[model samples]
Target: MPASASASSTTPAAGSTIHLPKTSESEQLLKIRHSMSHVMAMAVQKLFPRAQVTIGPWTETGFYYDFDSPEPFTEADLKAIRKEMIRIINKKLPLERIEVSRAEAEARIRAQNEPYKLEILAGIQEPITLYTLGQEWWDLCAGPHVAHTGELNPQAFELESVAGAYWRGDEHNAQLQRIYGTAWETAEQLAEHKHRREEAKRRDHRRLGTDLDLFSIEDEAGAGLVFWHPRGARMRLLIEDFWRQAHFAAGYELLYTPHVADLALWRTSGHLDFYSESMFGPMAVDERLYQLRPMNCPFHVLTYASRLRSYRELPIRWAELGTVYRYERPGVMHGLMRVRGFTQDDAHVFCLPEQITAEILRILDLTEEILSAFDFRSYEINLSTRPGKSIGEDAVWELATAGLVEALSRKGWAYTIDEGGGAFYGPKIDLKIEDAIGRMWQCSTIQLDFNLPERFQLEYVAADGSRQRPIMIHRAIFGSLERFFGIMTENYAGDFPFWLAPEQVRLLPVTDEVLPFAEQVLSQLSGAGIRASVDHSGDRLGKLIRNGEQMKIPVLAVIGAREAETAAVSLRSRRDGDLGSLPVAALLKAAERANLERGATLELASPGKEHS
Candidate 1:
C-alpha cells in the first residue's frame, strides 16, 4: 500500500517476523525498555545540557522521551545520542529508587531548573519516588526498572526517530522534541522488530494511496473525509458487487436509508443521550431539528416498526453499506483507517428468542467466509458479557450471552472471555484479524441487543396470536470499508490479487503491427468480464512492460508480430513467473475460471489443476 507495490510473496521465515510482545506482557522487558528511555534521556541531557526532559514512557514497541530543546534534533543527532547511550550502558550505572516527600521532590526538581518536571511533580500525589542513575542523573518516577544498566543488552536497542510533539500533548504549551527508540530482550528480537517496522512503513496505506492514485484526504474538503479517485472507485464497486452477491446468496435483503433524520428519532433511539459526544450537531429544517446519522440501526428499527409481522417471518435479515458521520477530534484522524465519515457494512437480524443460537452460528459462518475471501484466515475472538451498568433483565442478558457462547463453541472458535466489557445495551462478540506480517487489527463485531427492541416497543404476532418482542442482533463484517480497504492494501502491500486488482490485465504491443491484435485480445477479455486495458502510449515494448508491472497489473500480455500471427500472447505474471505463451482463447478461459472461483492467480502451469 506504500510507494512500493511489492510482488514478493516470500513470507519472512517463521521466526523472522516474530512478535515483540507488548510492554504489559513481559515484566522484564517492560522494565528494561522503561529504563532504556531514562538512559536515553540521561545521554541526551549529558550531550545537550540545554535540553529539559519532560515525560519519558515505554510504548507497545519501545520507548520515547520528550524534551524541550533549543533546536530541533537532526538525523546526525540520533547517531550521537546512540553513542552516548552506549557509553552510559557500558558504565553499568546502578539505578537506585529513593522515596522522597513532595517537598523534597519539589526542591530537587527546582534545583535542576526543569519547569516541566516541576509541573509534573505538582500534579502527582504524595509518596513521590525518584530513581537516581548513579550520581549523574535523577528524575521523578514510579518505576519497576532493572537494578543496574548491565541487565540491558546494548545490541538490542536502537535510537529510531525524532518528531515535534506538544508538551503534554497540549498545542498551547512549548513544543518538545520527541526521540523514539526500541529496546528488546535480545538482538534477534530487535532485528525482528526492525523488520516489522520497515515492512509496516512500506505498507503504510497513506503513502500507497497516493502512489497508486487510489484515494485521498483533502485539507480544504475537510479532515477525515476520503475522496476515492477513479481507480479506487472502480475497485470499490467491484468489492461492493462481490459483497452484494455474497449477502444475497446468504439470504440477506439490502436496504437504503436517508442520511439525515428527525432528531426525535435519535432521541427515541437513545443515541442523543448516550452517543451525543460522537454525533454532529443537529440542524434546523423548517423548525424541525434533523441530525446526520451516526448509526443506521435506528432507521432499520423504524423499518421493522412500519408494519406488524407474524412469527412465520421471525428472522428479518437486512444489510446496508450505510455512510455515517461522527465528529473526530482534530489531530486524531489518520488516513482512511480513522475517519470521521465512513461507510459501514452493517447488518441487523431480528429473530425469535429460541432462534438465537442458530442465527449467531449462521452469522459467524458468514463472517468467516467474507473475511477469508480477502485472505484474513486467522481471527482472535472475544465474548464480552454484560457490564456492571447495563440495561435488560438478568435473564435476558444470560440468554443472549449463552447464545453467543454456544454459537462460538459450535463454530469451534477458541475465544477469550472479557468480563463485564459489553455495551450498556447488550453483550457483544469482538473479532480481530491477523494479517500476513503478524499484525492484528480489530474489525468485525457481532452485538446482541435486547434494549433497543424494548425501547422501540417492537413486537410481532406469536403462534397463539399474542404480541411478543423479537430478539435483535447487530453485526458488521468489514466494520468500515475505509478501514478494511486500508488493512487490505497494507496486507497485500498494494499488490492486490488477480481477481481484486482494478486493472486485471494489460495488453502490451511490441510493434505497431500488432496494435490491432492487442485491441482484439482486449475485446475478448472484456467480453469475459475480465478488466483489461491496452497500452497505447506508443512507448517502447520494454517501457510498456515496465509501466504495467509498476502499476501492479496482474497479467501483462506481450503481443508481438509472432504472437499476432499465432493468435497467442506471451504472459508474464506477477504472481507466478513467465507463462511462456497462451492462445488468446486459453488465456480467456483461465482468467474467467480465476474470476469465477475468486482465485488469486491463473495457475496456467498445470492447465486444469488449481493452486489449492
Candidate 2:
C-alpha cells in the first residue's frame, strides 16, 4: 500500500482551515481592485472611446475588466494605457454605489451611448445597482468599494497586460479586450507580488527550454508540436522510467495504442458529435476517414472490448503515456502549459459494480504516490457529481457516485463536492496539486465514465456467467506531460532537485593542469550513473563556478592543483553553498546515493574523507 493510502489524522477535511483570499479580508485591497478596474476602463476609453464596458471582477490576485473595443489591444498599447491609468489614480476621485430602477438605469445608459450597460441591466435581477465615481464617471456595478478613491494606493496596482476574450466567456460571442491588473493591500504585498512575477518569469519553461536545450516548439512545423531536445528527452525518459516502475508496482498493465484511429471509433465513443471541434480534422485513408486522437480513452476502451473480460479480472488497471493532438486557438497557444500536441499519463480501469470503490481507492493512492515523488504533496480534491444533461441512468450514476464517496471515505481524504458539476457522461474527482510557490495546478483526475462502456457495448462475464456492462474509470495523474513539466519548472523556479537536475554535477578544472583529473572525475561520476560533466571551457575558477551556479547545477566540483594532486575535489552545492574539499571516491558515492534515493539535495561526505 502507498503511503497516501495509509490512514492519517494530518489530512485536511473539506472546507476546513483552507486559506482562500477573498475581498472581505482587506478593504484596501478591495478598493484598490475595484478602483484599478475603473482606471483600466478609463484608460481603454481614452485610447478607444468607442470601446463599451461590460464587466470587471476582482480575482484572487488581481482584477480584469472586459470591454467591447473596436481594435484588438497591442503590447505597446498596454504600456500607454498603464501610463494613463496612473494619471487617473493620481486624481483620487471618490467611488459611490447608487441604486436605481430599470427605466432610470436604461435612460442613463442610453444617454451615455453604452449599449452593453443596457444589456447588463437587462440581465441583472431586481433592485439594480450602479457605481458612480465623483458624478462624472459611472458604471453599472454592484460594488463593495473603498470609502474613498484615495484609499487605493496607486503604486500597489499595476496593469499587467491585455488579451482578447469573449464577451461573456462564450466563443460564439464577439471578442473583447480584457485588461488584467494586479492589486495589493499594501506596498509590501505589491512588492511581493512583483517578486513572484519576476520569479515566475525567470522560471518560465520557454526560457528554460531554450537555455537548457530541453525542448522547442518549431514554427516551421506549426504551433503546438513540441520537439524535445536531447537534455529534455533525457529528463522525460527518467520521469517515464519512474512512472512505469510505480505503475507496475501498483499492478497496472501498460498499453501502447495508435495515434490515429478510424472516425467510426470516435462516433462510437460519442466524441465525433460533441468533441469534434477540439479534435483534428479527419484524413482519407483508402476511402476511409481516420482522425488523429484528442484523447486516449476511446482507444483504451476499444482495447478492453477487444476481448471478453471475466469478473475474476475485475479492477483491471491499465495505463498509458499516450500522446494526443487537439485543436487549440492560435492566440491561446501558450508555451508548454497549453499545447495542441502533448502526451497524457492516462489510465483506465474496468471493474465490476461491486469493485468500484476499491478501484477508485487504488487510483487515489497511485495519484498521490506519483505526484508526491515529484514533490507535490498537498492537493485539493473536487468531487463533481452528475450534471443535468447526462447519458447514464439515475441508478448507475448513483452507484458510481456512492462508490466514489465510499472510496474517498475509506482513504480518509477530504474533497469538495461540486454539485451538478460532473460531465454529461459521469461524475469525477479532480485533484489540483499545490506547487512550491503556493500556486495550484490541476494535474490528476479520476472520473467514473459510464458513457464509453455503454456506447461500445463493453461487457464482462459476471459470477453468474451473465454478460454485464463493466464500469469504466478514466484517470490521468499528470493531466498533460507538457503542462505538468511547465508547472514543475515554475514550482522549482528552475532549480530542480538533485535527482531531476539535468546536469547534476559540473567538474570545474582550475587550469589546463587539472583538466585530465577533472575529466577522470567526471567519467567516474558518469560511470556511477551520475549526470556529471567537465567544463572544458578552461575559464578561471571563479568564472567557472559563476557559470555553474547560473545554470543551477546542483553540485560543482572544483579541481585545483593541490586537490587534483591529493585526489580530492573542492565541493560547492547550489543548496548548501561551499563545503571545503572531499576525496573523489566519497563525492562519487554521495552522488550515486542521491541519484538512487531521488534526494532533493546531495549530501557529501565530510571533508578529507577518502573511501578506500
Q: Which candidate is the best by TM-score?
A: 1
What are the clashing pairs of model 1? 1-493, 1-494
Most accurate candidate by lDDT: 1
- TM-score for each predicted model, relative to the true structure: 0.92, 0.88
In model 2, state the lDDT of residue 391.
86
How does model 1 fare in lDDT? 0.88
- What tens digits encode model 2's per-residue C-alpha lDDT throughout 1-612? 222322222222233343324454556567668777876787788878788898998876789999887788888888888888777666777788888999999999999898778788889997888877765678888777776667777777777888778876777888887888888766666666666567668778889888777889999999988998887887888889999999999999999999999999899888888899899999999999999999999888888888999899888889999999999978678999999999999999998888888899888888878888888887778899999899888998999999999999998887779999998889999888876655667788889888888888999998898999988999999998899988887778778899998889999888898888888888898888898899999788789988998788899988889888898888888998777788888888888888888999877655544322
Candidate 1 residue lDDT tens string, 429-527: 998887778777889999989888989999999999999989999999999999999999999999999888888999989878889989999999999
The pairs that clash in candidate 2 are: none
